[model samples]
Target: MNHAIFEKNSLILLIGTLIVVSIGGIVEIAPLFMIQSTIEKVEGMRPYSPLELAGRDIYVREGCYNCHSQMIRSLRDEIERYGHYSLAAESMYDHPFQWGSKRTGPDLARVGGKYSNDWHVEHMRSPRAVVSASIMPGYPFLAQTPLKAEHIEEQMRTLRIVGVPYTDEQIENAQADLLAQVSPEAPGGAEMQKRYPNAVFADSPSKAGVTEEDALVAYLQHLGVSVDFKLYDDKANIR
Candidate 1:
């Protein structure tokens, strides 16, 4: 019953600790299975297209997550500042998830469609040029660096293995989609649309071919624009 008794008998202490820990873990984890079903279903929540996924990789590679957070807390200020509060379904397909902890810059959860592609290109090239008071470093190299997407198919296959929902057709056309997103006039526009119905195809003037800037911009433009919150009751989905 006392600490001395448990310490005196190692076997008994081990057994008793395991029993206590198991009970505590079950108490915490058992309800998750049931509660998962009760999560509110929202419309327009779709997985990131191959192009967006590639851009996401570039985002992570550049340590953008170090300054920005993708998750917006369910708070009054956050909702007012960054549209509706973040939803679980918004990041359902994110492998490691980019719900960062720091806020050196503003939250980028709802940054998609918040600015034009040209504006983003300018900002990335020279953050101070766009925002005089900005402290973020410029990424001019992204525009100059050509995007390498030869392994895009393999990347999609790997993501699919990890629950990203990439289909065979999507994997097959990953390179084409990546090119088409940044080059709207490209020949694969039709194929890209067929594979990713919700994708945005636009011309990026930063590069003749696909550039790192194009990929990063594509990923940034997709931050929190997936779900259409207009149809949902904002008051009801605050949590």
Candidate 2:
């Protein structure tokens, strides 16, 4: 009865297609240009450290993104469950941005600091130990294998090329940030402070080399921190 409908290329279809495409493209890109203002407030958020940077390289090499995503969406269930909605600035440092397309497991953007180093080590060793039903493969090597610190500088350089900000001052003061994160009250506390007035220190350097566990921990800890269970308002600042 309506054979012509199958053959017809209606003008409405073209207009609708263009409208949908335009809206999607705008929604995808417009926020990028306007987000630096909000990102400025994430003072605690910083570039990954040398060893932790190396760990990140390992994370990428392992294709952790295959199962996990780093970006949390701006939805109610996501916010209520994961924490604050994912912010544009939180991910400004990610070169390609790991806001993965699917949630095979869960969003890792805020998985930083969700567990302890020992826990992460165990989870890497055996995901089932932590999550009874996790289909994740075990990374037991992360524990048995000591991380190589040799290429840390090269890694840092590579990140710099890719837009992760690491200042000469930060590099020089890296140890200070490392110390600050380790034991802020250690005997060398005064000395570290005196030396690195502007340096941000991390805690321990796991067997995974000199990667500051603290900085990595900081990055992890910051995930989902923006989640304030309270009602939302424009004035809300990320803690």
- Give me the candidate number with maximum lDDT: 1
Candidate 1, after superposition: displacement of residue 144 in Å?
0.7
RMSD of each: 4.3, 6.5
> What is candidate 1's lDDT per residue for 1-239, written digit by digit as tens?
46998989999989999999999999998998877454466677766776688788889998999999998887878888877778887877788899998999999999988998888999999999999999999999988888887887887788778767777777777776777787778888888877766577546885467888888888888777767777753766555
Report residue 61 deviation for candidate 2 (angstroms): 0.9
Instruction: Determine the backbone clash count of candidate 2.
Output: 18
Total residue pair clashes for candidate 1 = 0
Candidate No. with top TM-score:
1
Q: Rate the local accuracy (lDDT) of all candidates.
A: 0.81, 0.59
Please report, as a residue range, the 10-residue window in candidate 1 with the lowest summed lDDT.
Answer: 230-239
lDDT of 2 at 163: 75
Candidate 2: tens digits of C-alpha lDDT, residues 1-239: 65455347677667767999999999998988976554544544567654345455566667877888887677667766766667676677776676777888888876755676566655666889999999998865554454455555555677788777877765665544444444445445555445333223334435343332333344444444443434443324423
